[model samples]
Target: MLSLFSLAHAMEMAAASSIRTSPRASFLTSSTLKCGPNFISKTSIPANLMEKGHKRASLFSIRSQQSEPKDGSVILPPTSDSEANAVTIKDWEIGRMQDEIVSSQGIRIRRRPPTGPPLHYVGPFEFRLQNEGNTPRNILEEIVWHKHTEVSKLKERRPLIALKRALENAPPVRDFIGALKASHLRTGVPALIAEVKKASPSRGVLREDFDPVQIAQAYEKGGAACLSVLTDEKYFQGSFENLEAIRNAGVKCPLLCKEFIIEAWQIYYARAKGADAILLIAAILPDLDIKYMSKICKMLGLTTLVEVHNEEEMDRVLGIDGIQLIGINNRDLESFKVDISNTKKLLDSEHRQAIHDRDIIVVGESGLFTPDDISYVQEAGVKAVLVGESIVKQSDPTKGIAGLFGKDISV
Candidate 1:
């Protein structure tokens, strides 16, 4: 009796051979065998698989007879019908073997890395660095020394520590959805969640004003549902001081601290700076991470706007329980490309139905401007839209809001 492993190995080899002769033949044969942990009988396999199996067997037999036996073994003549069958099998096997070789070679080529620059070396007494003015260390040491310098400067600033302390004693803000619901109930449309971003690595300094409190006030007066303040000082040219200022300014709109959010410490710090919500980008975090962080957000009374980019991201986000709001980001993080159509693609009717069934609020984020742009996203089935450029650049940012909605939303 063949062990399961041996049977599997034989099947793999047979499949490989079939592939080398012809892809279609190999596909047909492989489809016939059910290989899952709970293996059903061949007859019970899917209809498509059965069709492929029949096609493979016919092809395999034809190919087998074409090649003469290498050891001068007597080639038994087959009847007319059997001759046809043998020829079919022979053809398929040859095609299958060819395919297997090509595929294996392709994989090997892909795995090999390109040859590049050669390594540099010096004699025992011949130090390259020693020849220069600063000659005490090697390349690796230089990198470490620079890193140490940076760390020393960072310690001197103590920004994160100050942020932690500020958050620890900070009072909690109002709920993000509650604020949105209130705005929407008062008016017919969902209110804006305007972001105050200075510079993005992708699209540099967006707002010259760069005042968090002023931006927060403008957004609130313009009938924004909430304020999303970017706090990444390095890439976004944002500061925690901006969040702190907006919180202390007594702006009516609930605040969302927009950060990269790789660590839990940031969440606690955001809460300390009077943030009502946090943006969690799904591209960087796994489902488990999102679930864990979301629970932490809830414990701190902070709403999480789980951001996804595509169908796979949406599916991953949906699998995790307790997600109330989903934000479809128009900008691709890896490529840094912005296409407002991304929101449309992700918010299909079927996806909308799934979200509706769970009572999830879908927020369209990035690359939005004008009443038409706002309407486009709203019609696509988002509960709200996040805008930055068109509104922030206006002479009267408050009027920019009315311009976007085509009506006074504050009323």
Candidate 2:
């Protein structure tokens, strides 16, 4: 058996070799590191493993000769020099990759850096400098950053395995797309996906007496083909509990889990909690993630409402296969600006022909209040509409739906 010192030396040389051969980018200097007995010191990480398209950089496995623990639970390896170098490099690569990706697609919103911000030292003090890499540029970016941390902890508590088992007792998946089509045909206008939202970052607390199940039942009674329940607890003041509660209350409207989905694990979690559909924003997720997540939704018998804010995002989602439902969110999530004309702009663009060809159902979302606003988007080619504040704030949410459409659409 090799001594600890010799083993560390060998590993350091191997790591250095890997870094030198990498082609994407290298941000580490060749230097040996020493650590305590419980720790492993590494010099560098492989470059090829840190490619632009590779998302597994932050999830690399650590190989150590430490003895196994008495408990069967997985052991978390102690932090090492190589891990620190890898994390810093991962942050840098993610930022660079996002720049390239966004340039091609014009996505201004940046993903939260894979690793947290780097630390700067000033003599005896340490400071974390704020930049695009560490700081969130917009509300949407900030929410995503918090979500990355939130989902990590949620996964630890109720892993994918547990979520799968829960699905055995989950409510049957409802036909979200079919409901929209049926409602549109029945109502002679865009079908409503009434939102069960209590609050939003842009507009605080829409309803003080918020009862998710109550709101859901009212919306269904008012002829909403589907319902969108915000599951983001931080920014939206919504939760999975609300979703489960509404579904268990026997509301027939297909429940859409309105969440900033960053991981595939969230898709399963939503299904297990009684969601018939889930929202996937094109601004935050790459094309690969969208495709993968959409497939998972299909397998779980869940519908995906892929949301886009601009022509670039609309174009990106159009290229992907198996996309049946697309949402044109009039509100620019980055700027928190609402423009009802965004829907018309995208539909009138070159994408309209392609969207028609694919038989894609486009849903106009946000900034829609009056019947004229509803008419504008319907003429712009949306088969559905997702409205929240205009309807949810009324003394009777059922009556609010009539005011929005200028007539009662209930059955």
Q: Which stretches in model 2 have alpha-carbon errors above 4 Å?
A: 1-99, 114-133
Model 2, C-alpha of 122: deviation from truth (Å): 9.2
Compute each candidate's TM-score over C-alphas. 0.62, 0.78
Clashing pairs in 2: none
The sequence of per-residue lDDT tens digits that candidate 1 reaches over residues 79-153 is 223223333333333334433432442211110111111111112111011111232133322322343344446
TM-score of 2: 0.78
Model 1 clash count equals 35
Q: Judging by lDDT against the true structure, name the best candidate.
A: 2
* lDDT for each residue of candidate 2 in 1-411, tens digit (9 for 90 to 100): 332223334555665455445555444232221111111112233333324323322222222234442324343333344445555344445556555665566666665543322221223221222322445778998998789779989999999899999999999999999999999999999999999999999999999999999899999999999999999999999999999999999999999999999888999999998999999999988776788788889999999999999988888999999899999999988888999999999997578899888999999999999999999999999999999999999989999999999999999
Model 2 / residue 403 / CA error / Å: 1.1
How does model 2 fare in lDDT? Answer: 0.78
